[model samples]
Target: MKNLVFNKLEPGTNIPYELLLLADETVEAINQYIFDCAVYLLNDGLQNIAVMALHPNSNTELEIKNIAVIESYRSQGIGSILMGKAKEIAKENSCTILTVGTSDTGFQQIRFYEKNGFVKKGIRKDFFTDNYPFPIYENGLQMRDMIILSHDLSE
Candidate 1:
């Protein structure tokens, strides 16, 4: 993490597609909300290692639309740093809640979010099946629903 820098990219700036694809399933899905979201890049003075995108979901809620760290950088606290930045942004915007959603099959992701102080809020049943043109699988299990989680920024 030497020379770590977190930079917020200008809206509509071209993003690192490969880095974003590490978290999202498809290009279409990534494009769906990216243009409207605030994109952030984490670099180690060499190359981009992680990305996070966030957008307002409502007057009081900010949603983490995408978050991904380079595969080699996982478990090194980069994701936690991104989550912490997201919370800071949410609070700065006077948002009361910060939300994120992941594939139901993302076991590690669920645990990661929980460890970051997010709590289960609800489920979007058949979200993947309804939105994605193809099936998505994680950890050998097919993805169907979306598990929505939220953190209380007001706290």
Candidate 2:
């Protein structure tokens, strides 16, 4: 698990970045609840650029609970690389599906996932209502629905 290029992120700041990226829990809850996660860094060790959360799924798929790239790191292909590592790990573990969920308002994330060949499989409306401290909006739209995306790793 540690063989991949992984780094350590400051707990509070990093968790909020995860929340902003996916509307997850606060930094505190994330620090306490979601313990199985990883961070990606540049080879130069300049930035803790990305985050990923790994956990067992109800089905055979492996859930990428969270993935994020800092704003300065966006548009540079770092997120894709991080996801590629996650997909590789999933395949190595004999998992057939790479699954993730994001708010409908996360337009950039939706585009990123779609660009990476993940398909929109389902939605859970109001998935973030009680989970986040404040309402989240993006691209002039409020994020109330959670969209589930999946990529078939077996293919």
Candidate 3:
């Protein structure tokens, strides 16, 4: 936990993108949005431990494109730390809503986001089946739809 610095990764800076691929399964999918999104990194002075991708969907909304923490760092409050920063950044950027979309199979993620104040907004039908080239599965369940969650940044 020492020297754990978290901040937005500036453009043209050397960033270890492999850390992002950990959360998002495909390079193609990530590449489609990487440049358009803002990359925030969590590092311990020596190595990368977590990453969160945020993108502006509109003047009043920001979308969490992806969030991932290394296995060894998971459940150690790093993710929550990133969420805390995300909310702050959203407010600073004048965005009123923060949203993230996860697959229907993401029970743990749903709980985590809900615990952090996000509420279910809507669902994107066949999102996984249409987007991912290969079948996506988790916990022995096939991921079919994308459940979108939103948090009001107006507070």
Candidate 4:
């Protein structure tokens, strides 16, 4: 990851909709929170390799609304680095908890979050079906619920 830079996306700049859409399903869903969240990009000097969008849910809680590493960069520990950066940002903002939600069908994602110190907290039943306009599937399973996970920053 030499020459990689992690920085906040400048205000008034065009949003990286394609990158963000990797984690989120639709532009409308991203637009709902993108403006309210702080978006960060991980650039490898020449191009962007990852993105994370965080929102301050409360004074003590920070939520990761979206996070994605370019497909070619998967399994290279880049996602973990982004998770670490998310924790740092959460702590810097006086947050005690860092939370993220993913589709229950995303088995790899669930394991990834757990490996990063986040524990299963709760689930929003039918979250995908309720929020998304179309069906979402992963690993041949329909995505119906959102599995919420949390990492205690105070730890």
* Best candidate according to TM-score: 4
Best by lDDT: 4
Candidate 1 lDDT over residue span 1-155, tens digit each:
56899999975677878999999988999989988899999998888999999999898999999999998889999999999999999988999999999999999999999999999999999999999998888999999999999999777
Model 1 pairs in collision: none
Which residue pairs show backbone clashes in model 4? none
User: Which tens-of-lDDT digit does each residue in 1-155 have in candidate 3?
Assistant: 66898878888986557888887788888888989989999988888899999999999999999999999889998989989989999999999999999989999999999999999999999999998999989879999999999999887
lDDT of each: 0.93, 0.70, 0.91, 0.95
Error of 3 at 113 (Å): 0.2
Candidate 3 residue spans exceeding 4 A from truth: none
**lDDT by residue (tens digit), candidate 2, 1-155:** 23335654446543445433443546654554366654334332653556676666744678887676667667878778878888887887788999888888888889999999899999987977756668766778877889999999888
Candidate 3: how many backbone clashes? 0
Q: lDDT score, residue 83, model 2?
A: 81
Query: For all candidates, what are the clash counts?
Result: 0, 0, 0, 0
Residue 145, candidate 3: how far off, in angstroms? 0.5
TM-score on alpha carbons, each prediction: 0.97, 0.77, 0.96, 0.98
The RMSD of every model to the true structure, in order and in angstroms, is 0.9, 4.7, 1.1, 0.7
